[model samples]
Target: MSKELRINSNKFIDQTTRLSFKFNGEKLYGYKGDTLASALLANNIHLVGRSFKYHRPRGIMTCGSEEPNAIVQIGNDPSLTDPNVRATEIELYEGLEAFSQNCWPNVKFDIGGINNLLSPLLPAGFYYKTFMWPASFWEKYEFFIRHSAGLGKSPTKPDPDIYDHKYYHCDVLVVGGGISGIMAAKLSAENNNETLLLDDKNILGGATIYQNNDCFQIDSTHTNYWLEKEIKNIKNIKNLTIKTRTSLAAYHGYNYLLAKENLTDHLSPDERKGKIRQRLWKIRAKKVIIATGSIERPLIFNNNDRPGIMLSSAIKKFIDFYGVKAGKEITLFTNNDSAYETAISLKKSGVNIVSIIDIRDKSSSKIVKEVEKHNIKIYWKHTIVNTEGYRRISFIEIMQLSDDGSGVIGKKIKLKTDCLGISGGWTPMVHLFTQSGGKLKFRSDDNVFFTRQE
Candidate 1:
């Protein structure tokens, strides 16, 4: 395949080493450090899967574990098959086989897609209401429902991979390896404490690593430069143990938790002969810091489940870190100021910024000014009413919000765009805290849920 969507500049990807993989039986090539999602975007293949209920076309929405779409079945071998794997989280490897699920016959032409037209008849409790009358025939109804409900197919044979468990005791345990987590681990280790830090990605510095613009500075140095220096300093700390590709799976009482460490999943089958596939880490820490960052929430619009509609942060990550552009012309719709950062990043990477539609009435922020200075149009108090295109987004219809902010007021204006990035502010990641018996309170200011301080 042609590298049409890939940027020419050298960034995080090692272009010297090329790896070939199969997606729905089509052979594709990607660089060494590219994820399956980034590789797919680089080749302009965004229709990755079908939705669960309506069978609507879905693409890669986010670049991490918070991804709601782009789940696929991995491996052709039954014994090695893994289903419901997030394409964004999987690292690219040679001979990797990925197939779209939840679609009958094929993903491109699925018969199950009739559910989209019949979605109006199928309400939230349609299954329970329709199947409850016939008591004796319930088993027959369940069999048909169960077969069509799930997304991917499970392995018929047992998994043929080795897995082990280990235990560790540390004075300080940091769940997220983002900039905040790294700083906490550094300070703990400097005080001679046994510090342990974990991150789901293979690299450190988190989102800060992708932020290369000079607008952000810390102590007169660029944010990326400062983060790089801090990461280098933390690596020299003796008491700190950094674990990459390790995700915190569960949090128990008394500061106990479980983390899953990926070992050989990123390697080729031939290279993973005797290596363990995964290891479970049972950790006990005296003190814990949950620094897991927030996830970008998408805007609610008509036909929003269509392919090529992704989160704003995911777009920035793909362009800044992976050197891949989702589209040549992009339109961003946001309700807050955070998405302006994505606009700047995309513009700097040579991607066309068609326009930015902000739901608020007006804004005088520096980022907004910067975006307008580049001649990018900003439509304030406007919201998308409809979207066009089937397998991928081709255009969107937007209108100005009413004075009461309850509905659209003006005529719909259509804009042609290949990609749409939406941001509805962020909801703090408090799942681990809530799992450990913590209470949460909703903040009305930003419409986010946060843990209540003790």
Candidate 2:
């Protein structure tokens, strides 16, 4: 067990910063300036959820949108609960109740473990195979399937809280707060363009704040500081509004974007103070640069739904940004160059990395060379075939894959570990580009789809 810590409420907020919250129906306390994820971490409660299929244990994986775990059912009523919400991203207020999703009875103990014993009988798209067998019994079997599917639960009652949408005008809009986002914002501010940078996280420093993570090879904090200095130096372009606790939900023609602001939920349920809980900001920009970044794709395999398995990017946020250790031992499975940064970062953080299983044949890339220097063992043309763990990942079975990636056809390798980090590749969030009617094409080099000329 880890040590538990609490806020010295009296020092941070006036009128005694006491707020009530609940997790799994057990009431807890929170204070002002606490996001649901942070508050939960403060309590030393690591397991907040379970895996999708195998009912394995899950903890918060990231602090921001990149989170793959820590998603929970918030609020008491059906309408109030936001399913699949990143706990680290939500601000906590008094009376904020949450519960683990994808778990039966409780997150710690689940009947789903039985799936592991019968895993060999399951594979990717197993549901498609099982539902057809009896044909006549499909209807009866569907009930059990539905109950075991999906993350989070629906509230039985209506939501008591209110949520609403605002329109503003800006000369420039930056969609991310990472290095690129900050650089764009700084440049816009310098050019005297009324600039606004929007990010869903509570802090303006995006991935840079987690400098200890392996992905952060450069000095992210220094870059952030330079951006801050640049913002301060400009007198004319200084009219910039950086929305940290805001997300750009949509983009429209003429460069219009919609943003949402969470106002009161982080303080306490009763501390509304008659202020609007949320507001929508519609902004028109002459130019928009989306540093919106990318999301990790999970590898397809049998029993991949085991708990404790998540995107590698998520691990960085949990350990570096949240100051919370996700697991004692972690195994990273990747088919790309990016996940190597995660393995390196975890090793540097004193977290034991069981091994790195890479599916690539060979790489002349600089990152691959670095992996060799670090002495991190790499598996070529291999992928995870199955996993075993309950409420958390305990071990993984990897097998060599056919060159065409249609199937696995080599000897199996197994490693003992607690967490499994996977990344098939990345999916650039090109919603805005597509919403603007932009076309996307496959990029052979990146092995991803990117916006291309029509």
The number of clashing residue pairs in each candidate reads 0, 13
Model 2 residue-pair collision total: 13
Which residue ranges in model 1 land beyond 4 Å of their true spot?
Answer: 132-143
For residues 1-454, write the lDDT of model 2, one tens digit per residue: 1322332222223224556688888777655555677566556566787667655567765556657777888765555667877887777666787888887777777777567567788788888976898888988998988877777666677655666766778888888887678778878877888888888766565655444433234445444345445434432355677887787788788887788887765655556756677878878888888887777787877767655666787775555444444566778888887777776666655677778888888777765677677777788788888887645567888888898878899688888987777888888888888887788998998778899986
Q: Give the TM-score of candidate 1.
A: 0.97
- Model 1 clash pairs are none
Quote the lDDT for 255 in model 2.
86
Per-residue lDDT over 189-273 for candidate 1, one digit per residue giving the tens place of the 0 to 100 score: 9999999999999999888877776678888887877898999899999999999999999999999999999999999999999
RMSD of each: 1.5, 5.8
Where in model 2 is the C-alpha error above 4 Å?
4-21, 26-63, 66-70, 77-84, 92-95, 101-104, 107-165, 212-237, 364-375, 401-410
Candidate lDDT values, in order: 0.91, 0.70
- What lDDT score is found at residue 354 in candidate 1? 88
